[model samples]
Target: HSLHCQHPNTNFCILTRPNTHTHTHSMVDCHILLYIFPGQGAINPALQFAKHLIRMGVKVTIVTTVFAHRRITAPIPEVLTIVAFSDGYDEGFKLGDHDAQHFASELRSHGSRAIAELITASINEEGQGHPITHLVYTMGQTWAAEVARGLHIPSTPLWIQPATVFHIYYYYFNGYGDMIRKHTTTDPSCPIEIPGLPLLLTSRDLPSLLVPSNSNSYSFALPAFKEQLEYLLDTETNPPKVLVNTFDAIEPVALRAIEKFNLIPIGPLVPPPSLDRKDYAEWLNSKPESSVVYVSFGSFVVLSKQQMEEIARGLLESRLPFMWVIRETEEIGDKLEELEQGGIVVPWCSQVDVLSHPSLGCFVSHCGWNSSLESLVSGVPMVGFPQFTDQTTNAKLIEDVWKTGVRVTPNEEGIVNGDEIKRCIEMVMGGEEFTRNAKKWKALASKAVKEGGSLDMNLKAFVDEL
Candidate 1:
């Protein structure tokens, strides 16, 4: 293990003589620390994963930015401890107001040093329970692994997206980026083939971060992805195990695509139902079975005014009972009042509870991985309207690979017009095939995550390996 040094403003780096004791690969000796970015999508699964580890008698600590820590309003596990450190923005960092690259850099520098200090404290304080024997982190947090390196602690990356996105990013950084860029630059819809993936892919199907058109907007993403893969590759021995939030049965091909790393499937790390599910449960119980369409674009994406208008018009035209989660309804003008009469619109609601409701027939989504996995486990079909990041690829997987839903195509002006939205929702709702596929995937997801199942066995195996 190594020592920690303090810096100027908001640092608590402490160093002392660590207990000079030998350790074994037992669950009792294993204490894990998970570092996550300030996103609901990432935090949900990380918390769930922590609960699983805690159940197995391992100590777990969750580290995040102060701004993120302040925003967590739900109750977490009692045994689990969460620590917050500054990310240069104690309040919050707005993407519209600041540069993405600057925030990312600050996150890395501050996060790495802060995590290093925590690991140092746990090591030196003999009564602080146990030393953090392992470090597990989420995507876009490659810097956490570097701290693990300095301290000689075992580390792993918990991939929150589907393993297919991991494969695409690997190839993108490892010399195949130019081909994808060339095709995407010319025509996004043109057919292309990635070396490892069996399915025929298009430039349109790739992660928006890798697309050239989005370079100016999501400038920080591709480089961050490249840095993650490069770090894993640069490790000569003891390569950190890759943990994905998908089961093997679903993504058999992509999970095994990379020869260099062993990608472990220990998930659909979907958490149990939240505490405040009573109100939504009552609301959904009042609606008829398979009668409601659930619409939500997960946290980050800010839809264009034209796009929002189209969505409102589409929902009204479909005449289906819907529950739309519009955080900033002011952006949509007075359309909220009209829509509320036919359906429901709220700033926030529990997604898991909504998806699991019997009344929910079709999901109008941004195709974020968390939402996709939740919909899959709930047996709900989807109308995928992806906004950015790995969402397009996840949508592609949902439609083409999983066969659980249909992805929508935006019109010439890049707006998913009301007619198209209405058409997709109607098709998804009316089709028996989609429903059957959804139920089948739902059963498979349950089997993988249930007691004595693949996921349970995999988690045990992972702990043993640690």
Candidate 2:
């Protein structure tokens, strides 16, 4: 008997048969579907991984919001297929904190169901020659699991941040939210050690969301945050195998903590930039090694006006020629204008190209996991100024565990002044010990991604399991 399923929105159909009589057949073609999250940083890594898998002969498809699909300018690989969500794409939607949270919740509620139905229809339309063999999804969108379960396919959850953030979320799940809140706001200076985690961290080392305060508009985000945490802890029906976007050498402690869970570490997955390396080389050819400080905060971490001024002043005070990637939102008029008068402020430079530049020196960053790993791979020391999310944890790994960077302490108003910023940047760039350690990490990271490396073996194991 054959069963047919049709999509309401598109001319797509799927036909299937319930097996009764068995017959020998050759190996069936497999389709691997990746569900990408909305964030740009998240989308980049998903695209990188999809491209890599496709090059290795795995058929890959991406299901993301229509809005995101439009923002990306990079050429899509021919072997990879894109399936946009049903929500109409409009780039102009002004989403507030509450609206963003509501949208996330709605996606969790119905987004996966819509994508799954579409996949069924598309497969049927293609004459049922290939079936989806596996589904890999980003965290926070629990709906992907529904589709994977419905089709009896293995589902993997990709954690785009360091596993240390997961440890914090686990603590929150076990009724430690108040503890985290107290540490981040009331007594940020005190060191708090989490059980099974490697390093002792202070309140300021946790994500800003866990920091106690009622002033911000993120109060609406609390529920969604809690919902995501609950979903992470839920291991029964949605037993997702985990894949983290981090190298083993960068966060060994966090990696050790999640060892018992079915997890794979395959990362520093940054693709080389499209621009010619010689162009970047020509720009940096005159500079001295360990002399230039490269600055960039990840996409979403916005800096206040005061913070921007402080950072600008600090960079000027350091008296170092720097390459800073300033987002339009983070530019506080005269602060960046003034900095541009002194340093190079490119709106969006190719980050990997910048990092790999021969004359590039120190990285002054928010310590996002991606940036951190990139710095390591490039053999550059860092000056960590963590802003939010997993950045706090990543900062600790850089400053405390790796000993390749220094953390700038914010003042009473939660701001790091220009002088302190200058001091940290100068120290990381000028200190021989820091440079030596950074180069060591760079060597290790390079070896980790090579054939027979730890991450390479882990990737092989992951594909083998699938």
Which predicted model would earn the best lDDT?
A: 1
The true-structure Cα RMSD of candidate 1 reads: 4.6
For candidate 2, the 10 contiguous residues with the lowest summed lDDT are 19-28
What is candidate 2's lDDT per residue for 310-333, written digit by digit as tens?
A: 888898888888878777656566
CA deviation > 4 Å runs, candidate 1: 1-26, 238-240, 275-277
Residue 320 displacement in candidate 2 (angstroms) = 1.1
State the weakest 10-residue window (summed lDDT) of model 1: 14-23
Error of 1 at 347 (Å): 0.9
Looking at model 2, residue 114 earns an lDDT score of 56
Clashing pairs in 1: none
Clashing residue pairs found in predicted model 2: none
Clash counts per candidate, in order, are 0, 0
State the displacement of the C-alpha of residue 173, model 2, in Å, after optimal TM-score superposition: 1.2
lDDT of 1 by residue, 71-174 (tens): 66666656567777777788677668887788888988988887888888788887756888989999767888988879998788899999999999888888
